[model samples]
Target: METAFTPFQSLAGGALIGVASVLLMGLMGRIMGATGVLAGLLMPANLADWSWRAAVVAGMVSGPIAVMLVTGEFPQVQVPVSSTMLVIGGLIVGVGVTFGAGCTSGHGVCGMARLSPRSIAATLTFMLATGVTVYVLRHVMGG
Candidate 1:
């Protein structure tokens, strides 16, 4: 089936993300990277840091719920893979985060925004890898 493209919704979501990132960095002195934030919870420097990390995670989880409550429907989601594949993919991503030192949100959004060379390189690598993977899957493997 054809899906609807909502440019206004996409723009609003991106604007909200930008505003939240700025406010987070300005007020809390933290980068609004979900993986890094979640990782911090696993290895917090001090006890006080845990509270804000928990709150951030809680907010992430609650966002979709809040949207559903306000709109009376959840956003459409389609997963073509099996549940086992999903779990395995998540585990692989977790391991990748450890090796890469950060995930896409950390390197692509927050890092690039800060004009860090490391992040710039990491984002480029991410895009290249993604492009190659898609090509392999769609063309080579007939996925």
Candidate 2:
């Protein structure tokens, strides 16, 4: 429940994220939304663009894995729920991925970078929904 990250570590992580976002947008002219990238990979018409998207996703995934392998500093995750609950949560997230027209990474990082109004709305919705969900599940539902 408690994070072991020092203030410096947290700040460095935030800085790295910002740097990566800037580089990704400036260099690729692409939104770094994991879901959209993966969806592009799944589309037959997007075969020509698959490699870059796949690499982006791979790099994002592999970066953390590499860190854990090298430093053995994997962060702990605590989810006080059953597999069924997790599955339900996943389904809800999937729906959000579809309805929101972009995932948090896409809207928060990429859209915000482009100064998009839709992205701003989407990001606010994500924050508000997450806060409300947490409150309901932890307090109202006594989960």
Candidate 3:
């Protein structure tokens, strides 16, 4: 099925993300990577560090709630797989993040913005892998 495309919304969201990244780096001296922030929360070394990590996680959780309150409806989410499959996919992604040293937001956005060669390579690998995975699932495996 054809999907609805909202260019304005997408552009606005991307701009917000860019601003957030810049602000986080400027004010906190931290990279705005969800995975890294969540991981830090799980294994914080000090109370001060833990507080910001907790706040980040809370803000992430509350973002959809705030949007729903403003819009008078929850955002549409389409999940094409079973819950078990979703959980498995999440676990695999966690493993991949660990191996890759960073997630997409970290390497693709922040790292590339800083002109890191490693991040550029990592981002390219991520895009290529995602494209190959989609091709394999949709055509080769007929998933």
Among these predictions, the greatest lDDT belongs to: 3
> In model 1, where do residues sit more than 4 Å from their true spots?
1-6
Q: After superposition, how far is residue 76 of candidate 2 from its true place, in Å?
A: 2.8
- Model 3: runs farther than 4 Å from truth? none
- lDDT for each candidate structure: 0.86, 0.81, 0.89
Q: Please provide, for model 2 over 36-127, each residue's C-alpha lDDT reduced to its tens digit, 9 standing for 90 to 100.
A: 88888787356558887777778777766776897798755667779998999889999999999989988998888788999999999999
Per-residue CA lDDT of model 1 for 58-80, tens digit only, reads: 88888789889989998777887
Which of candidates 1 and 2 is the stronger one according to lDDT?
1
Error of 2 at 66 (Å): 2.4
lDDT of 1 at 142: 81
Count of backbone clashes for each model?
0, 0, 0
Q: Give the TM-score of candidate 1.
A: 0.87
Per-residue lDDT, model 3, residue 68, is 92
lDDT for 3 in candidate 3 is 49
- After superposing all C-alphas onto the true structure, candidate 2 shows an RMSD in angstroms of 2.5
